[model samples]
Target: MDKENARNTTIFLVCMVALLVFYEIFVIGPREKQRQAQQHAVAAQQQAVAAAAPGAATYVNRAQALAGSPRVQIDTPALQGSVALKGGRLDDLFLKGYRQGLAKDSPPVELFRPEGAKQAYFAESTWVGPALTPGPLTQWTLASGTVLSPGHPIGLTWSNGAGLDFARTIAVDDHYMFTVSDQVTNHGTAPIKLAPYASVQRQGEPELSKTNIIHEGAVGSLGGQLRLIAFKPWKKQGDTTFTSTGGWLGITDKYWLAAIVPDQTAQVKAQFRVDTVNGVNVYEADDVGAIRTLAPGATTTSNTRIFAGAKKVSVLANYEKTLGVPHFDDAVDWGHFWFLTRPIFWLLETIHGYVGNFGIAILLLTVVLRGLMFPFANKSYESMSKMKKLAPEIDIIKKRNDKDPAKVQQETMALYQREKINPLMGCLPVLVQIPIFFSLYKVLYVSLEMRHAPFFGWVQDLSARDPTSFVNLFGLLPFSPASVPMIGGILDGPLHIGVYPILYAATMWLSTAMSSQSITDPTQKMVSQLMPVMLLYFFASTPAGLVVYWVASNLFTVGQQYIIMRRFKVDNPIDSLIAKLRGARTPSAAAG
Candidate 1:
């Protein structure tokens, strides 16, 4: 019994390690590449636009609207504010510029017209109290050294004056790329060290750099999510060439959060670079004068613009000069199975577009994928069915070798050969699909198409858990609020933690129950039961879209198993094993 247990343990350990290694190589590696490609494409587009239009600085104003789909206004009575999303994607913080560093009690970026400045639409968001008093927009400063006073290009700046500098007209071509630009000049007597940085920050969330407190505990890892960072470059001496700083850009998705960064030194004159290649935005930042010992009145120039937006792979591919940044985007970490599973994501997305329903699309996608893999699953099922049919004969052999452990294994192997059955065959199909399962998870988690998408009653927000209750008793415990289970919490707390998570947990349990019934192997049976419990605790607060997929996938697998078993007449192998145990308990049977 000890020897048999050891062998089983070894097999389990080996399988897990194999799965992890495969996941890192295929799923994680591709995700890294995707993020890189995205960065490159964004950079190239900016450089290309700069090269094409010398007067692009005219379009470098701030406060320009996001490219597609006007922002949606969110109305809440408790808070005297509204939430609007630009470009159909919402990160942890909404505004990307300096205004994001303002007080936390601010609203989304909006119009701020001064008494008599340029009256240009520079991007910025301001939050005036309910009393409506005005002063220097506290916690804010203008990067431009224009005469500083009240009503001097005042309120706040968004897009870093890019909107004031540029004119935006929808392209006639059927392509989708958004671009912005800005120019920086050395007006000072002495050279000012300059660097270009970019960030996409959502309100009430963390920023995307080492300097920000929000970025603490979220460094040096991609979190298997998309990251967009601007690359800052310096100009060489006589060559006057651009030298890439080549700093590492980080990506992590914790709730409504993601960020990116670049390397820069002292300030320098700069220009905005924009490239709209086949309707794709390429954003770049140039910081000149890294090593130059500026004369008393020396001058140099650099520009910066960013293709700051969603991960639309088709659009990004058009910009070719980003040194492969656009291609290296990241999807959510779904595990190691994404190589095959991503196809399912594409399929689900495609169907969702036509049907206008993500849930229905997932159902259809699951059906199609299961159908394709049916043959392989069927083969494995058949092997197990045959083995079950020979169980009585195998029991006799086991009884004969009851005193000899080695002989028991040898006899079992010989019996399997006679029956043309391979015990491991039952697990191979599972092994092959693990990565695909995880990849699908990544797609489901990162794709913005499912945000706020609904499934059914109680599941109105597919991007978060389906709330069923409101008590948050767990919140008072020592456990981390982020790591707490289901919808239950402090009913009287200041925060209104929703009730959808409890429903999500229930649905997961139901799905797991239905799928666990069909597994014949004791070890697999245990895993089937244990894994869902582990995941339910892990994903209680995970994005609703991910939990939705998990619940749906589990239910679909259960239905598939039911259909396969009924159509093929495969018996429950556990029943006979139970019967054998029952017989062994009888005194006469035990003596025999």
Candidate 2:
């Protein structure tokens, strides 16, 4: 049954690949052509209009400067930051005020709120010194109420009783990261016991209406609007290692670093806590332990760095010294496939810097990635070559063992041992690359660097689908339809489709054909075929960058397989397989 299922799965995979190829060739290609035609038509119309109106040139000049004036009005700093994070709001800490263009259309890189809504506050005790505050951390939006009234910005400040310069300038680029430091000091004559608990809360506003997108399964089945992406800690974890508390500190892909010290010679206990609060995240680091005696003037300090940003492998690897955290580096989840995916992204980024065409970069990247993985592909092909060479013997085994399962297994095992071949040996390299494949998926999804970026040629927008549409008397259509009504052209039916998806599907099919074998089991084969089709459907609406990665990966696989077959001197896997089957057919084959 297992064998049958495996065979069926193989077949299904092959079929799916074939379907993708067909879609790319027949549907997507033509659609892309139609889109190009439409674009040309629009360009001509624009040209004619420009020519007809002498005042059009004046209008263009006015609009051009008008466009540059606002953006070039002031050198408002380039979106500066090592990373960017989007802030989501929940009930506890709602985002109020002019949310007009804030989070309505795009994700929020910075957070803004009103004084009435400043229900949450972050406070920590640090040694009285200049090291703590070199400069003020700019707030994206300050509380209007507080700004109108007398007093400083809504924040906390501690007096440096010890009289030491503890100054540090840490900038908060995006709403993604928050920093917390604690300084335990003997300010009083006697020993002091202090456990600081920090909380960032969100208060509800009755009058202000908030704009938010509802994610599926964000708040369980109940499904409420997502207000903030925060996490908290409920219980303390350890001494000097407080459970990372607050919504942004101790979650997956949320990296946190810390340094703590006890009083001169005494030991300080710090416990990190993390927990969920009604879907709003909170994390707190409590300073544990008490100073027995200050002995006049003594102080201790703790420093921490917290980063809540996109899960990019290289970025995670950059801080590996903190700890070899998994899923943080350039590692893929889909097994061996990542070996190809990671490199593909790297190459595309590299080429994009010079050529400025993500699409072409992807094409080049695919070529390079395939060259790198060619050795594995060659080994696989060599194995298959050997298998094919031994197919005759294998057929004989099948003929003799029509029903002897036990004998078949024994003979096959003996044949493999004799030939110094492991039937599953070829599978390792393929499996190893799976992680790279999965990582590629994640890389494409999280990297804002690729957002809305364009590629050359017909792909003016690599971030979105190549739109091709025609509107008939039947009103406008969402996408260009493949067919129209009786008047057909009247509805301006979609005559052509986007070629990229189809091209992607084709590339997958070619790779599968060269890499995969036909499965004998009907069910498994069916599954194999359905996999690619399902994938095609999934990829249809995904970001073009992701699609580009997959396409490149597939093409690389094909090239790698070709190299493996030609370069590797390994025996044919099929020929060996055949010999094993034939050997199993003999009743006393093992005796020899």
Candidate 3:
């Protein structure tokens, strides 16, 4: 039996290692090569474009792009930027509340950059019609206000040489929403058709998290259904078009959004497209309203709203409730388990509101969850404790039937049935914890509130990986271990585990070890020992808040199991270690 068990363990380990090697070589290696090739192609294309056109869209800086166009100032409480009068585009804006980095002096988070800039992103509203219509290059004259702000709107106007006149009024809320109203008056002898069109365009791909947990790309709600397309797929698929009466579409980052919401009652055609201009990929989400015929001496008006800023849950929910934007809160990437993730975020936020610290709130939330699951966990631990007490009887059965493995198993089952102990009862708590763990992980990964939220003692950003790496002895050393040339990358990768992960690993080991004593199979015992170590590496780069939650949960489980073991008079590692320590101390006490 022992030989067979050892063989099975060896085979299991070998298969796992082989699978990992195959995945890395076949899956990861090819994808990485493809990504590198794409990057090189883009670089070559940029160089070609720059050579062909000296002052084209080839990496012009933001300051230069902003200076190349005349503009009207935007000075709202939540936004600061200028609208380019050249195209009358909301192409330069910053979020006043967020910074590019965690440092106090870091620049305000930029939401929009002008056309010629590298990675330029902006939103624009225009009339889609004749060649003379106010388009990207048609210079507009400011007619009304000098500054755009809440309760104050600015007007811009343009005219076709033939007699078609266009006027645009742009207004902003105290927050991130912009209201763009466009009016066209046809004074020509003949009738002309025009449609309102709005687009949010992004030039060049921004840095992405590259994980499947949260989405970062084109997103929208059209015809009552939500659509999400990532960058690669968006390029591959070319253009996706939809016709919906009332909907919203946009390009989204992990925590930021630039969406266009058309009139709730108007039928419009929406599209998400990726185009290569001057060798740079430009991603756009746009909507065009139904065409209206402008007769002689007649006018038409259109209103479109643009949402560009942070994806705060409350803020999005408020927009959904007030503006009637469908699934606006879905911008947060709540995942398929939104039912659980949303409630978890709400509870965490509420607890933080009262406690004044997210870390403390997480701790209290764990306690509350454990309390809710107390009955189920109590039964599981009780069954485990009872099973531990039956270990001697099971061992005797094994010894008595040493030659016949079938008899050993038969008698063990008989013993369990006679004792009314359900061997599977111990798995109930683990099954219940799976969804809760993922839900909490999603909350920590995507919630804006968790971003840069500080916990006590070194955990300044709950959403970021723990910074005090074990490679640098938890930052006690003067030098960074990750800075040591060739091996630095490895050290900074999985080997960059920190204090919270170590604590989590220790608690997991203790909890698993406590339960593992009842597991008699050698293969099961070996797997039990390896699982915590494997998870330690897997979770080393996860958000610190999630590690903290796991640590607290494991501690709670250990304490609860210890109490149940004591009640059943079952021997456990904690009691055995305490006994050995007392035995060792007796000699010292006598000598003293």
- Residues 1-592 of candidate 3 have per-residue lDDT tens digits of 3324534764476458456645544565458657768978977877677868855566667889999889999998889999999999999999999887788998999989999877899999988887378878889999999899999999999998888899999999988999999998989999998889999999989878746788999999999999999988998889999999888999999999999999999999999999987667889999999989989999999999999999999999999999999999998999989999999999999999999999899999999999898999999888888888988999899899999988887788788789887777777798899899999999999998999899999998999889888887898888786698977655776577899999998999999888877777777677777767777766777899999898999999999999999999988889998999999999999999
Which residue segments of model 2 deviate by more than 4 Å? Answer: 1-108, 112-115, 118-369, 385-429, 447-501, 514-530, 538-543, 559-592
TM-score of each: 0.49, 0.46, 0.93
CA lDDT for candidate 1: 0.40
Over the stretch 485-534, how does candidate 2's per-residue lDDT look in tens digits?
Answer: 45343222223324556667677666554444422234543554455555
Residue 252 of model 1, lDDT score: 33
Model 3, runs deviating above 4 Å: 1-49, 52-57
Query: How many clashes would you count in candidate 2?
Result: 99
The lDDT of each candidate is 0.40, 0.40, 0.88
Q: Runs in model 1 with CA error above 4 Å?
A: 1-303, 308-344, 469-544, 550-552, 559-569, 573-592
Using TM-score as the yardstick, the better of models 1 and 2 is: 1
lDDT of 1 by residue, 62-121 (tens): 233222222322222111111122311221113222122225454543322111111221
> Better model by TM-score, 1 or 3?
3
